[model samples]
Target: MFENATKQLRETVEAALPELNTVVGWRAGYDPLHMTPVFIKNAGDLSKLEWSPFCVQNLSGYLVKDPAVRAQDPSKKIGICVKGCDSRSLVALIQEKFIERNQIHVFGIPCRGTVDWRRVMKLGPLTGIQSARVEESRLVVEDANGGHTFALEDVLARKCLRCAHPNPVIHDVLIGEPVTPRVAVENSYGEVERMEEQSLEDRLGFWKKELDKCLRCYACRNACPLCVCQDRCIAETREPRWLTQRVGTSEKFLFHFIHALHLAGRCTECGECERACPMEIPVTLIKEKLNKITLELMSYEAGMDPEAVPPLLTFNPGETGL
Candidate 1:
């Protein structure tokens, strides 16, 4: 499946290169178990493009966050490869007017979850990996020591396990067969629901404990596709003084909570924030809770429809059903 999808992706991109300024995809990172975003400007670089469970970074953020991408020639469209979750981020960016539909050519690939390298390493440490591949719902890694196997479920990212949209929501080209979602949208909030069962005090204590582990790196903020505040971010601005450089649980709580709040009706739940966190904090959970509340209160899901305005972004005094 991986080989076929990658072959088709390369062929498709090769054909579209003439009409694009650049194509953003993935390539093997420093190791076999990791994948990093790659930018392809010509056919010669198409061989670098890869599609696999290890390709986990949400490349959509480059459209809005990268200065080079933001300043690129508008006449030539940029090509982007997106997974199920990443496609939603693209839609959200379109809805927010960060990027226009015509400005991008999306190569959407249906995803069957992605590997959590941290989870894989936790199960068993590996170094000098010669190769890694998914076979029959199991991950097989080959190294100098030989082959190691792990159940895919045991190493998949938590968000992927609960993915409700395994097929791209928007796409100009479909890369592979569509996949059945692991969970229905209505039941996708199991983690948040489980957290809600705990008492307020327990929840507070839980957040205090988790937040204390924060390194104040802003990796979560920077990784988020909807966090478009950029240079004017409250965390960096002393003009408003919303946050200080103090490194305490309170300070961490302030930064994370505010970050989540800012994405209340905007978060796409692509799990980039959690994935990017070097501290291994489940920072995405805070935004997941907000997304849940937004869904229930407004019966709206972020990034599902680019034409629809976010409920919180507009006012409707006569609107009922709350």
Candidate 2:
């Protein structure tokens, strides 16, 4: 199904390359079960471009967080292929003025869902993956030994399973037919709602247990597209001396909370933080809780509209009920 879409994507990018400095997309990773970001500057490299469930990285991050992208000639627009969630991150960056809307040529691809490689590996325990593909709501993998099949739901990334926007909110060109979202907008925060059912003590205990495993590697912060304050991050800065080298639950709790608080009304819930965490922490959930609060109190969802301002970022004199 995605073969035709991939073909169209390459054709579109190739045609647009004359006016673009680079077109960022995905290519096969070290294994069949993974995909990595690829920068297509010339037509010859289009064959390496791919589109599949394994294309999990949010390419939007490169726009704001990558130095290479920053070094490009400002006059030449950068092209990008974005899934629904990834497009939201792009919108958030545009809303924050990290990159101008006119600076990008977007080839929006409607995503069905992306595979969670960790989930696939866990279920497979099956090794030496030679090839993998999705067909008829199932993931089929061929390894050295033989073939294995797993239900799509069993291997799909947690974020994709709950995706409320399968079609890009903004795009210069659409690559494929739009897909129906797995969940409705009103039901997007089901996970956050479930956690809210826990008592206060339980909630605190839950965070304590989860955060204790934190390595403080700052993977979550670095992976976030909106976290553009890398040079003066509180976690590492010694001038103000916020966090210490000590390994303790309280310190970890503080670090995680501060990280989440920084993105309160800005996170697009792209799931990069959680996916990047080596400890398998559900780091994005921290931001999700904040997102839910912003939605309920201010009736705003981040990154949905490029022109709209984030609720927390602006003030209204007549606003009430804080």
- Model 2 gets an lDDT of 0.91
How far does residue 231 in candidate 1 sit from its true spot (Å)?
1.7
Error of 1 at 79 (Å): 0.4
Candidate 2 lDDT by residue in tens digits, 1-322: 6678888988999999999999999999999998989999889999999998889999998898789987998899999999999999999999989999999999999999999989999987777889999986999999988999999999998999889988899999999889899998678888899999999999999999999999999898888888889878988888889888999998899999998999999999999999999999998999999998888888889899999999888889987656
Against the reference, the lDDT scores of all candidates come to 0.92, 0.91
Candidate 1 residues lying further than 4 Å off, grouped into runs, are none
Model 2 ranges with Cα > 4 A deviation: none
Of candidate 2, the 10-residue stretch with the lowest lDDT total is 313-322
Local lDDT at 12 for model 1? 95
The alpha-carbon deviation from the true structure for residue 291 of candidate 1, after best TM-score superposition, in angstroms, is 1.1
